[model samples]
Every structure is written in structure tokens, then in C-alpha cells.
Target: MRFSLLLMVCALCSVSQAALTFILGAHENVCFGVFTDQPRTSISYYFAVQSGGAFDVDYTIKNPRGEVIVTEDKQRQGDFIINADIAGEYELCFSNSMSTYAEKVIDFEIKVENDKNDFKANMPDQPNAKPKAHIENMGKTVDKIDQKLDELLRAIQYYKTRNNRNQATVKSTESRIYYFSIFEVLLMVGMAGLQITVVQLFFKGSRKQLV
Candidate 1:
């Protein structure tokens, strides 16, 4: 009975450790990759100046497409709240983009939070999780390559979507200009006819006086 209870406790701990964390040194940037069967619900983040930070920092979140989802500037240590409507692995970036000449040590924390308590509870108990790693560095390399390829595909799709929207906007603007030019030409013709009628009326009055 005790052994069964011990296994359950370990399983719970493993579920929590499933999250990944990273630290960025001063003037340094990094990328993180994520794999999830369930959708990610939120990004819980924190930032601090481990040393020599009297100024603010700039940070942003990027999707695989290199599109920025969220940004914060002149920010200090605090909790920034966010929600992802779609569930996938996302990137959190801290930029020294605004750091002054002085090399400042900035510390940031990121946790990929998922709120699937119901799903986690229903997770099949892994009684045989025996350090699942092989000596194949080649396999790891191949896996990394595959992951990169997937990201590239997603990025291309995102940019293509944006390009299509821009093209649509240009076409709409062209249509509007084309219509406006026609309208302006018609208005000018009407004004010219009005001027000719006024001149003829003025001459008829002089002819009647001569008669």
C-alpha cells in the first residue's frame, strides 16, 4: 500500500516538473522550444535586474512566425498577465534593445503554464517511466531538425497570410481611386456646361436691347 502511494506522489511531482525554465544573462538572448499534447493556457513571467539595473528593460513574446504577440518596455519586476487563444508552444524574449552602454545583468523567468487540471488528472499513470533516453545524439539532432522544419513551415504560412491581407488592401484602395477619378471628371463636365449657359443668357439680353 505504501509503495502504491509513493508512486502516486512521484507522478504528481513529475506533472509539475513538466514545465521548462530558463535564465538569460546580461546582454544575452535565447529561444525555447516546447512540446505539448494539451493546449497552453497562459504565460506566467517575471523580470528582475540581478545587478546594476536602475533603468527599464524591453521584452516581447514571439510566435513561431517571428510575429510579436506581446511587448513591454520600461518594465520592472512584476507579473505580466497574458492569455493565448490558441494552444501551441510560444517564445518569450527579453531584449537588451534599450540597455545603455553599461552592461547590465538582467534576470527573467518564464513558465509555460497549462490549465488542464482535468486532463492532468485523467493522465494515464506512467508506472514504467524508466529514464527514457538513448545514447543516440544523432536521433536528438534529427529531432531538432524536424522541429525546426515545422517552425519554418508555420512561419511561412503566417507571412503568407499577412501578405494576402496587404494585397487585398492595395486592391481596395485602387478601386476607390479609380471610382473617384471618374466622379471628378463628370463633375468638371457639368460645371463647364453651367458656365456656357450663363454666358449665352448674358448675350441674349444684349441682342434684345439692340433689336
Candidate 2:
């Protein structure tokens, strides 16, 4: 049973890591690309060159209105991490409503990080490079990484279960709190009504005695 559980965990980790990342480059070796693994998310962007030889990127975010939504100007060979608030068909386009100008070839390393998986996957910037270290060390590192990945996968499962349980607990607590607040309001109204009645009766009795 333990081995089966471990195998299942390993499979889940592998799938998450094998996710596809999309990238696009325009004008030969000027490899301008954005990375995203989620198919449901799409992005559109427009690129233009500035006066100072820097790059300008204007973007219309997910579910674009066929008009510009956001702009990223003067970007150079580095990461452009997109932090999205809601999940949908997010897109990024390059070079629309602007000049299609670019300089010499530039290299880029884009990463598409996902949040819904149990595995801590890795995508090498240059996967075709010569193998590092001796073959013996490479084997050892592979074994160690597999062990760590197994442990991480188990942790992800544990945390996911914990989060679900906590959500239910929070909802129940909130309902109780709401009812308690309503009860408090009703009690205050009843007390106020009683006080007003007592005050009116006291005044009426005093007036009758005086008469």
C-alpha cells in the first residue's frame, strides 16, 4: 500500500512537470516569447521600439476588448512575470497599433509556473547543454532529487486535505457568528422597548398621583 501511494504521488508530480509552455519569437533570433502552461489562459500584446533603443510593449489583458488594457514599455532580455487576479482566457500580443521594429538578436528565458500541482517541477533554461559534473555525481543527484520530489508530493497532498477541512470549519464558524450577531440585535431592541414602556408608565402614575 505504501509503495502504491508513493507511485501515485510520483505520477502526479511527473504530469505537473510535463505541462506545455508556450513561447513566440518574432524577427529571426530576437527570441521574444512569453511562457504560460495553462491552456485556459491567453494573452495579447503589442510591441514597439522607443527612442532610446529600448522596447515598448502594450498589452490588452485576458478577454481583450480589441483595445489596449495595460502597457509594458522598455523591456529587455529578462523575465516578465504575469500576476493574474482571475483565471480566464488571458492573452499577450506583440506589435499591434505600434511600429514593428526590433533590434539585433536577443535571448530570453521564460518560465511558466503553475500552482495547481503537487510536484515541484523544473524546466532548464538550456536543456541541450553538456552534462554537468561527472556521470557518477549526476546519477547521485538524480536519486536525491527523486527522493525530495516524492516527499514534496506527499506534502502537497497533506496540505490540500488540510485546506479543504479548514474551509469547512471557517464556514461553520462564520454562520455561528452571523446568528449570534442577529440575536444580539434582537436583544438590544427588546431592552429598548422595555425601557421606553417603563418610562411612560412611571410618568403616567406620577401624574395620576398629582391629580
**For this target, which candidate reaches the highest TM-score against the unseen true structure?**
1
> Tens digits of per-residue lDDT for model 2 on 1-211?
0000011112233221211122223332221323343333212222222221223333333222233345454342222335533333334433322434433222112223344222323433366665544544775787699759756854664454356446656777999999999999999999999999999999999999999
lDDT tens string, model 1, 1-211? 0000011112233222122223444565554433233444555555554333443456677654567877777654445545645545556555554544534444444444456454445656577544334424554687589659746854664455456546656777999999999999999999999999999999999999999
lDDT of each: 0.52, 0.40
Clashes of each: 0, 13
Model 2 has an lDDT value of 0.40
Cα error, candidate 1, residue 178 (Å)? 72
* C-alpha positional error of residue 144 in candidate 2 after TM-score superposition, expressed in Å: 4.0
